[model samples]
Target chain A: MSDLSPAALSPGGTIGILGGGQLGRMIALAAGPLGLDCHVFCPDPDSPAFRVAARHTVAEYTDTEALKAFAESVDVVTYEFENVPAETLELIAPHAPIRPGAKSLAVSQDRLSERRFLAEIGVPTAAHARVDGEDDIVAGLETTGAPAILKTRRFGYDGKGQTTVRDASDAERAFAAIGGQPAILEERIDFRIECSVVVARSEDGQAVVYDIAENRHENHILKISRVPADIEPRTAQEAAEIGIKTADALGHVGVVAVELFVVGSGDDERLIANEIAPRVHNSGHWTQDGTAASQFENHVRAVAGWPLVAPHRHFDVEMENLIGHDVDRWPDLVAEAGAHLHLYGKRDVRPGRKMGHVNRVRPRER
Target chain B: MSDLSPAALSPGGTIGILGGGQLGRMIALAAGPLGLDCHVFCPDPDSPAFRVAARHTVAEYTDTEALKAFAESVDVVTYEFENVPAETLELIAPHAPIRPGAKSLAVSQDRLSERRFLAEIGVPTAAHARVDGEDDIVAGLETTGAPAILKTRRFGYDGKGQTTVRDASDAERAFAAIGGQPAILEERIDFRIECSVVVARSEDGQAVVYDIAENRHENHILKISRVPADIEPRTAQEAAEIGIKTADALGHVGVVAVELFVVGSGDDERLIANEIAPRVHNSGHWTQDGTAASQFENHVRAVAGWPLVAPHRHFDVEMENLIGHDVDRWPDLVAEAGAHLHLYGKRDVRPGRKMGHVNRVRPRER
Candidate 1:
């Protein structure tokens, strides 16, 4: 367990943030209110974080010179995403303290490594096997059986690099669909609900998990997340316990999201690890308006070596993603009363793009 | 009551803001999430609002060219403060839609006008009279009685521009202290608690008020505000009714705050309108975390010719302003469990300055 006190980080301290997307932009927004100045380094000149940040570096992540300069500019570094290149992490590690560390990213970024690591730690996960080529895929399929997912080992998100192998006829198609890259084949586990546990861990090993969030997906894109997930109290507690242990196993400092599949029914809806997001996540968006401390702020605190906030649910919250054209409904949402709307300062809203979200909170009856 | 619907406006519309302080900065923050860009025209280049605003014009309020250019840049103009210069308002009015209108500003900018306007609308207010000179002051004092407060008709706030005429001996000092400006003398009402009502109105005359907020001030600067104010249910209802009527009387649009004195005791502690703020206000800061719709967002919604959100409070909340050196406690506040902290990106922290605030919320008890 890591043991870091959030109170040690004072106002006027500099926070180094990698990835300048809307998540990073929101993190910077949350950091501003704590008197913490943010230095955002992103390859894109149009990164929304740059608009409000105190300082921004527009250079590729792997550029050593730019990375070094960025590392030296801040007291600590935290990335908004896990896919940052390993070499970039090495270049930054020596200059400023990097959290959720390079090691955690190394495992989580690759599916093969993440599965092996989770299995080694005795965590319940899908039955799986790694495949490198056509022959390997066939052998793995024999062991994992049909009705499974074949996913590329790295750089896949939003269902972009995976295919479902329903039967023998689909095996070759699934393999070719993924371009036969180094991949992982896992037996699909039928589940009752797709839920996520978002936990923030400090260096001192203290962990806090927000209420499990029930997620609904559309075309592999997260469309909505509702807090107070429809699960028994015991199930929720067990999910949080798994989250705490996972953070500890990774030696994680900052927020980590564990995606889980709840199998069976009633008292037997056992949760199995699906994937890990080593940063503030979409599932936790409800915290922005429904909790005492937003996930972004807590993540910032964890990376900045501050105390962890006690995650709390202030209301039964439903958060819906405004994907592309859905954003056109901003006028209606704004007037919907009791809806907290957050739009990323993205210029163009294309199809499947996450432009904003609306959080509707229903207070408990008084 | 003015009536307007948000569907009447299009995206890329402009919102003219009056004050460029943190409240304006926050309003701009909220506006960005809804696809509405902000054009902040303030006298200070270092105004916090300038940091994140899409467009900003640094010019004196009295500069007609600057005000007109500012108005031309946006579809609608709203203000962060109520004391905008009347001449400046006239300059901007013709070029763009101005919310809460020039008349609302005229009423709020002067103490006598606000009281008279409230009184005319059947709203209860403290006894007040115009004080043009020493003779008027002497006669007004005799009629309004001793221990009354003498305040400037314009440019006064946070206990500034006012003196308490405790007796005959304090009359000359009170008169000289205000620099003999156009002033108003008011008989101070005895009150149990200082409370405020925050309301938003669309152009079409629809109005919505948040629950009454109880305020505590120290040295004229707001120190704390608690929502779900420990007031009677009828008192809260009356406060909202008063706010709606005030907005109707002024034909106001956008968010307006009415500060009131809860006079008398218990059941008899009726509400007396203190003053009106024709913009997003400090008293409603708790909405940032405790309510589904923050006051900043609601203000933008109303002025954008959109439907106003009737956001409900998620928790019973208390907001404490971090003033001057109090901001140094950010680390401690962030470390405290369940504390939602916000700091303005103000570079300097001077005494009595509002650096930021923290909201602590608890679930509403059944």
Candidate 2:
């Protein structure tokens, strides 16, 4: 792959975005001020990303003709999510460059592979084993022990496609729950807190990482994320190091979020790699208002072959996601002084849906 | 005019934007998020707004058929600037709803008329007199005196179409320079500071104002704006009142800005209405990143007939315009973590041109 100068690309160049969700919508929004045009491709007509894009193709990712047309029109291709198919990437790649490349998709698409890839790169992860059938499940439980999680190898998100195995007796039920798909069983390592580092890398290898973020989840959905993450500076540094190493290993370009479990006793803080999101993650939403350059803008910059902008913290920040009925509080949120509210312009507020978020900068005590 | 609820508008509904500039592009940008289409009617195809808008009519404002076609296709019409022609308003009025309506434009388009309207409504304004031509110039100066400003009644902006009549002889030259057009002579009252209030009102008569903005200008162009303008509580209240009263008098149904000059000494702080902008003003640009609800969103809400969102400030914000070559520092601005850089996506960087801006939020010091 080759790198292009930012100025050479100019503002009129088109960037292709896959997955027309709020993330894609935000990427398009961020791209606007940079003088870049975005073309969003998604099967759904109601995709939020479609609203802001200069052009959109309403076709399945598997539709090669439409995909070819989209790729030809754009200077480069990027995605808003990690679930992009290898074939879709292969189709787009021959026409225009795809960033965070297919290698990232291959590694992140499957749980077993991602863990194996992490271990191969000398990144610490939980003890894990693959389970193909009932017999394999028994062996995996024996090796990884009980109190481990059994997750399907692909298409799992927000705690979906996974089952918790607390005891040996839960093996069959867990196996049956996942419909006996190819799965991975990992030891449920105890961790004091869940933290993530959002890092962006340009094609030329320059990388920038935001401050570590501490995240809280409810029912497998993110609830709140605080930046500068109430953690030791060493832990934050290590988390960023892990993120950079992971990005380098995957030859990733564009923004990627690496979720980590900060574990162990005092003076022994260690981070275990949990997952690598090849695109901007929900936990990094704080960047929109709390930091100088947002993850969205940085992602656009990276994919456009621009220089990586160093992220800075404007204030200690807290971001809360508005889930389901939470969106109804927009009026109240709007009235609250010093609260930055962002609605995705999503009409349907279904259960577990991400409607919007609010970032409040905590004023430093004088 | 009748109001249309958010639910009443659909994806294909055309929105007619009155001016062809960066603000129109931004409004068009926001319109896409709501799934509403945009049709920009401006005489300049080279208009920056044309790049992002879906459709455009590049015809003279006086082209009745062009305006009619534009108005007929759109559900509602809004404007980027307050200087629309009376005939242009008449051309579209019977066809579609024009928001921040024609009445507001009539008052704001002419300096003398705006002052008269404000003064008639018992709103405080600097002492002034109308000057029809060079003959009345002397007498008008006699009433307002030296150090007054001689300004053409219409088509003036960024200090253009006007001159400072510092003395009697200067007043004569100023009158001749304006080609003796009808103009306004106003006493250049000493002001402590320049500030503006941005307010949005719905057709249902609900209105909300953002924090008072203290502004600084260089060469007639806004240079920087700070929110939570260091002012007494009473002055802030008065500023909001001025905005509300101005909006009400204009029968405005969209975002409006009331720029005022703070005069007088301690314990007697007084506000003198300077001008009315029937569209979003440059002083409100900080709201995009520093407020809970952006002025753009509020304007959309107002024109869409939705409930106006209450404006909320997130941080003490300073917005600095990236005028002309100032945008050359975008790399540094982008690298500065706390600065939110917004480039207008304009192609050229002419002197005195508003290329973009950066909003920096400083930590609230104790």
Candidate 3:
């Protein structure tokens, strides 16, 4: 049989990564065992991914020369985050194939584009309207209704660049609070719980959606993710479908994670797709020790054009992120039985910063 | 509780590893997620471990100046192989604490000393005699019985530096075959099967012995290791006891592997201790995917003065080593549903060289 394929990379092939945070660090870590090397390109000199990567290019994303050199040196290009500038992708496009491609990146970068794309795919999202200025806020509220959140259309994460619009009168101040940026207003849905589905898609359209993870956030940062989500089995299946649909729609070649709001409970439970992260995400971290192949490994496999590992989870897992000073408890965490600890090699622990995570695994009861 | 301990290292600590083969490479890989960095010291510039490590020192093992610098730079030191010279350890001892200490290294480096030490610990080994010169081979053969194998006392691995003797008549030829080195003659074991036990020991003397693994060899190199070895429960328990006893006797602070030859069958089955490896052995590689903490991770945890995870078996596993051109089968292996592939980043593929391994995991049967 022929051992060659169009997008398939041999063992020693190099993968170029755009960000150098924990997610990039983990993807790079996962690549090493697969005999794949990584060249991490990031502006920060002290990026965590640099510690484990075979190569690191310390240059701004906008620097075309550095981006070109980095792109040419690798077999394929992938990013850890969604905010990579379009110009950067344009420059790298001539050199290496970028997985999850430009369309997914562009759609996920802007809130308006993301919701519109979700709507176009027949996926259910919250009622939302565009707000370009103070005058548009009233019209946006008229469509979205009161008690909505006015969020910036671009460059927002961790609850930043957003504010609460209690009513029509509160729209002007909320719009001013967000620095008059292009924004979208959405009616706040009082969901029963928050959850996410992580799915990996191969170049041939084969996809593996991990078990939906019920999530809890503190200060708008994901604090914990538990597998075997409390949602009904039907709701879980529906959530996974949303993830696979989003991946197929984007023609994504790597992992895609969709954050959803479970609006009801038991037989009435319904999922509302809220956000799409086109990369290996924190909510899926439980797979590292709970399943056969983690999201990181599947992402690497997908981008390298290898077959995806079906998510065969062996244990019920609860992944807790050690944010900020919470990481100082590593001594106790590492000593705990059944706790699989993964600490990003970040020396400083600032408040709200993700220092590491611990996956607590137990024998599957179901 | 206070986070300070004598041998314990903090999250950002560096571990200085001696030897840079696949074992060292895996140890470095395991350290990454624990927030620890590694500095690999090996003479070969093309060492496989260098790619995954944060720092690499390419220098001769006997270079005291280089060894001293490497030891002083890291919180602790450990070796991936037993052949680390005595003088090298003496120099490094003044700078950093070495795991699987000098005593364990000394015992494992020489075949006679290893057997003698095992005997003193109430372990069973084959009857053997030493031969320092060609003339002594006859006496050694007579003591060990006619058909025997003469193995060098030092620097031997993977069936290298040894020869087999048919009887006393073939003594001179067999002695000459091993370069007339200080050797030991052992009665050829006509055994039912070969197996191994891997045990990890912490600084506090806590030990966790894994289930015995039955091993198969081709061309004297490990070809496969299957966990839940087809041995009686009593025999398996006895094998684990030998592993833990050996580790505790030497005050070993990392992983220890004991290879054993099983003789007879059913009620008469018994174990004959053969060789001891002071580092993680190939027989334990199955743990990477079949268990919560891999042998490499457990070894890192032990050497780092962290707590050890009890051997918690999750799957019945068969780990096959892909030697030389066997790695050319990566395309097919990666596509296999239950196979977890790990390729050592070795660019060359000379015959008998280990290129990678695949762990085939299945649900536990017994």
Candidate 4:
């Protein structure tokens, strides 16, 4: 992918987004100021991104005719999530260029491959082993021990498609919980906190990483994200370096987020890579109000082949997600001073669904 | 209009915009974050606002059927520009309430009426007289004197429909230039500087005014506006008070701009009202990047019956318009540090057409 010539997108060019969710809606919002038009292709007609996009095609990703028309209409293609099938990419690649490329997607789609890729690139990750069946699970438990997590190798998100294995007997139950899919057995390491580093890379290998964001999750769903993560300067630097290295190795042409866990304490504290999200992550939402260049805008710029601006954080920010019934407090939140509310325009608020997020910024001196 | 009860709009409610230009586009952009959808109604098929709006109606303003359909689709109605005909407002008013009401539009539409309204409200304005024809122009010049301006009483903007009268002999030519339309003759005051105050008012008479912006015009079109206008504190306060008074007098439910001229020197300095814009003004464009709450967002909140936030300036800002060929420098401008570019997405760049604007912000302490 790096050897391929990078074509710069003009202001009037259209960007095709694969998923029409909150992330795609935000990217479309940012693209408007840059004089770029957005065309969203999503299977759901009720997708929130359609409201803000210049054009949208409501069709399944597997619909070849719809995908062909969408690709031909856009100058560049990008996706909001990493679970897009490789076959869909293969179809779109013949018409329009897909940023972050297939290598990043392929590596991050499966948990086993992501862990192996990180280790191959000298990025430290949790101890894990690929599990195939009863024998593989028995062998994995013998090596990694009990109190490990049995996660399906593909299509897992927000703690779904995975379960904790307390002992040898629990392995079979965990496997059954995941519907007997291919899985990975990993030791659950005790860590101080969880944080993520979002980095943007251009086609020519130039990369810029945002400040670390400390995230707190409830029910495996992101609840709050605060920028200028509370970590030693050395740990922050190491996290950024790991993010850049991961993006560079994948030849990614858009934003990539690397989730990491801080292990140990004091001088011995170090970052351990936990997971890789080859697209915009929820943790980076704080950058919208905290920094001069937001992750979404930077991704648009990188994929558009424009020079990247150094991400500068001018204010301390805390972004809180409004999930499910939490959005019911919107009337009160709208009146809160210094709070910038961004509702996704979701019509239904099912339990555990992310409806929107609010960003609050305070001056650094304050 | 005040007797009509104010209804607060929910987050998902739709706002109907009367014109589809850069202002409408910006308002639509601001509405998205507040969880509001926008529907633009304009006659021009090439309208830039249509690209960002969720819905749009393309029909002449006189088309009552289209107007009724558009009005019924929206919860509240507002306009980008002030030239909308009174008849159009009458048609929409039966279905949806028009913010800023008909009084603001009626007064600001005709120069003679605006001057009279300002004077009646104790707001000092430039000396002027109504001109019905050549005889009126001659009689007006006898009192206002030479070196005065002859401008159409209605439908005049950006130096159009007006001419400069240098001497008595120029009266006939000036009247002919305006096509014998009813006009106003005003004495051109020697002013040290030009500035404007943008004030937003809610239905209940609560008002918030942005910082004064020093303006520079090229051929009567706004070229640049710098916030924290160079003016005495007393003059700035006076200007704000005048803006609030004007908005209150008209029972304006949205944003209103009052252009003023600074006269005298030292302690004798004072502000003289020059013109009134019953909608968002170009000079307030700086608020988009320089303040925590932009003028556009404030306008939306006011018209939506939401409480207004105090216009707080977080940074010193200079907003420069990219008119006509000036947009050609976008490639270079995009690379400039601390510069936030907002392109209007206009397809054609005719001379004097407002292509876009760029805002440069500097820290207040710096």
Q: What is candidate 1's CA lDDT for residue B36? A: 66
In order, candidate lDDTs are 0.83, 0.83, 0.93, 0.89
Q: Lowest summed-lDDT stretch of 10 residues in model 3 chain A?
A: A1-10
Clashing pairs in 2: A292-B337
What TM-score describes the B chain of model 1?
Answer: 0.95
Better of 1 and 2 by TM-score: 1
Q: Tens digit of lDDT per residue, candidate 3, span A113-174?
A: 99999999999999999888987888887878888899999999999999999988987799
Q: Which residue ranges in model 4 land beyond 4 Å of their true spot?
A: A1-6, B1-6
Error of 4 at B237 (Å): 1.7
**Model 2: share of true interface contacts reproduced:** 0.18
Which ranges in model 1 have alpha carbons more than 4 Å from their true place? A1-8, A51-55, A166-173, A363-366, B1-16, B54-59, B62-69, B166-170, B230-232
* Candidate 3, residue B140: how far the Cα is off, in Å: 1.3
lDDT of 2 by residue, B1-366 (tens): 233454434434667898878788788776654445678888976776665566788999999899989999888999998778889889999998899887898889989889989989888998788988666767777788788888899998988888888776676688888778899988997999999999998887889999999999999989999987877789989999999988888889989999999986567898999989999889998898776567887887678666665776767899999899998786566657567777777778899999888888875441
TM-score of chain A of 2: 0.96
Ranking 3 against 4 by DockQ, winner: 3
- On lDDT, the stronger of 1 and 4 is 4
- Considering only chain B, what TM-score does candidate 4 achieve? 0.97
Candidate 3 chain A vs. true chain A: TM-score?
0.98
Q: Which is better, 2 or 4, measured by lDDT?
A: 4
Best candidate according to TM-score: 3
Give one digit per residue, the lDDT tens place, for model 4 in B1-366: 122233888778999999999999999988888889999999999788888878899999999899999999999999998899989999999899899899999999999999999999999988888999888877888777788999998989989998999888888998999899999999888898899999999998889999999999999999999978888888998999999999999999989999999988679898889889999989999998888788999999888888777888988999999999999888777778899989988998899999999999888753
Report the lDDT tens digits of candidate 4 across residue range A1-366. Answer: 122234888778899999999999999888888888999999999898889888999998899999999999999999999999888998999999999799999999999999999999999988888888856777788767788889999999998998898888777778888899999999888989899999999888879999999998899999999877888888999999999999999989899999999988779999989899999889999988777789999999888887676898888899999999999888777778888888998999899999999999888753
